[model samples]
Target: MEVKLHDIGEGMTEGDIISYLVKEGDRVSVDQPLVEVQTEKMVAELTSPANGTVKEILIDVGKTITVGTTILTIASEQGADPAPAKEETAATVAPAAPSQKSMIMERPKGAPLSNRVKAAPYTRKVAREHDVDITLVEGTGRAGRITVEDVLRYVEERDNGKTKAAAAPEKTPSVEKEPVHQPEEEFDTIPFKGRRKQIAMKMSQSLFTIPHVCHYEEIDMTELLDFRKELKAMDENISVAAFFIKALAIALKEYPVFNAKLDEENEVIRLEKSVHMGIAADAEEGLIVPVVRDADKKSLRAIHQEMKELTQKAKENKLTVKEITGSTFTISNVGPMGSIGATPIINYPETGLMAFHKTKKMPVVNEHDEIVIRSMMNVTMTFDHRVADGGTAIAFTNRFKSLIENPKKLMLELV
Candidate 1:
């Protein structure tokens, strides 16, 4: 059976082969990861569909191939003789001396061959911008492939003179000190591919297609903080973001327009039956939002657990297609990163996005007219003006704010 590259969802048409987990002649189980492919949104592990013995690998690592292309040939039965490796063709003899370019291309004695340098196209680009020879930098990825981090680490070491000292350096001509000022100007160029490209496209579309209206509110989280501490004492590791998600879910129920999607072609507002909350998590590749399905139906602890699992999977580049899609509403919490506030763009197809910043202690007048120190947090909501009016947006944010500010009321409703 031929193991073709199947669609990994999100309308992805192609993927770059990151690395192969199994080699020819290796037996694989059904659903076992066969290879890691870098798609537009994430690096996903393409799995074997059936139990089989790997026969032939059609695609090489770092090669971008279209979907439905056969990547591997597998024998359905075991003990099949593996196909022989392709023979290399004899090199044609060239006349006399090599050209200037060919001479410069020669690897240093004892250095790794350029053709053997295992690096992604983006990693190679970074190497070029820094003038760092990738063949000299050791690869740290699977199968000794060079990753972005490895290239960056090499650049750092070279800049710090650690790696340079280990290798022979080119001689520089001595010049007398004459107050010559040469400021060092350096920058890295990151190729917009994979997840970063997807993020850029979606963000641009959301900003242009949706008429956005932002509503800002500040909530006192002192009570919420106390409640979290109490929960923590009980060994419940629920976070403040979970509480905010719950409050947003409740508010969405009250204001259905905010929980709806706009069908511009049909000119209709489709209210979602269930609240699926997307948590915008910053992963290594880029920003990815993994959704929590039926968030309104789950308890705060359940939500927290799911959030942790999804976040971990996202960061580890293990998120499934179902986990990263289908959110009616999304929340981006920059609070942990020490951001005070942010006007986040709406996640495309979703009508609203909620952004919250770091909580800080400040003096505020209490209901009893006494000035008291309290933990305050800023919350911003960016909504589609087409799907919801300004009044509806304001009401929704106010309801959300009210729930967050009154922790007891919010907890009682949960009960």
Candidate 2:
């Protein structure tokens, strides 16, 4: 039987073979990962269709091939195995078939006694680690909910041997035999594809291939906040986040080393002139980093317009291939998520990434020794230590700090 490579979606015409999880002649089971393919935007794994001996892998790494192309051949005994199922093309999953009016959606079975426990994903993961029947753990959350913390506490108790059965002095005999049941929560599982897959591959590569160093700086954004307020009053659509990107662009101009790319093949660093900045936007589907070309040369309005258009297009799933490619530096701002700080992974080929975190109102003393409530944001930059030094990263951050603290300086730079 031949296994054809089907498009998994995200507008990819072809995929570059990343690596094969299985080899020719290896017996594989259904749902087993067979190979990983890298599209320009992300990576995706193709799984085996049936239990069969691999006959051949027609595709090789770094080779780009079109969709519906036959990439592998497998040998299966007739009537011995069911035909492995293939996923429908990268388009949306076909909607569920209409059920008869009399049909009832039967929930999946869980804990022995009750059919109504709901747990979060993290909580379920924690329960599995502790070997605890989640359905049996009494939920303290609203409407009988199980939180991640609840599961963690249960694990800690078990680790401490604090169970009544373990610490009790009197032994009791079992009276009646009954099945122990736990309630299971309903969850929608999303497959990793497109940008999610690219993030994973780039993270793995950065961890293994590059020696990375992260430096942290807490920026006093009191001035920046005031500037943002003024800007918002003037034009509400221009986000403070876009201003942050402008700051980063100016910073790159001064610290060119931080903007350079690591040539892994040549073991050298190459500094380029054009500053293409990647703004990481969280869309309903996944994380997309759309680049702003020549950001330093463009006016604040142009940058804001481009960022807005790119983000909107990204959300609408209408970004062209050209819009998402060729970024020199990347910024992932999770401030909207309320994260205080994070050391983000460097997007490969590019040596640095800056993660902007939530701003908080904190008490601070100025040089005048006066206590004041000020807005503070933490900016963390992760760089490939092989190419850039601590001084380079710090300088880049300092320039960013200056631009953000004084937004008017950006207009001057633009002219």
**Each candidate's lDDT (Cα)?**
0.81, 0.74
Model 1: per-residue Cα lDDT over 229-303, one tens digit each: 888898887888888899999999989888899876697889999999999999888998899999999999899
**What are the TM-scores, per candidate, against the unseen true structure?**
0.67, 0.57
Native-to-model Cα distance after best TM-score fit, residue 285 in candidate 2, in Å:
3.3
Q: Which prediction has the highest lDDT against the true structure?
A: 1
| Candidate number with greatest TM-score | 1
The reply for model 2, stretches above 4 Å from the true place, is 1-195, 235-237
Candidate 2 local lDDT, 1-415, one digit each (tens): 7776675643334556778898887988888888887664545678888777888777776565556667787777453434455534324445545572223245334333344466554356557756888976767754556755576566677778776556668868978879888899899997554456445544654565568899999888877677767877887556777788777877888888878897756877899798899888887656678889988788777888898899888788677657887789998889889999877878766889999898999999989999999988988999989888998788888888877877677667764
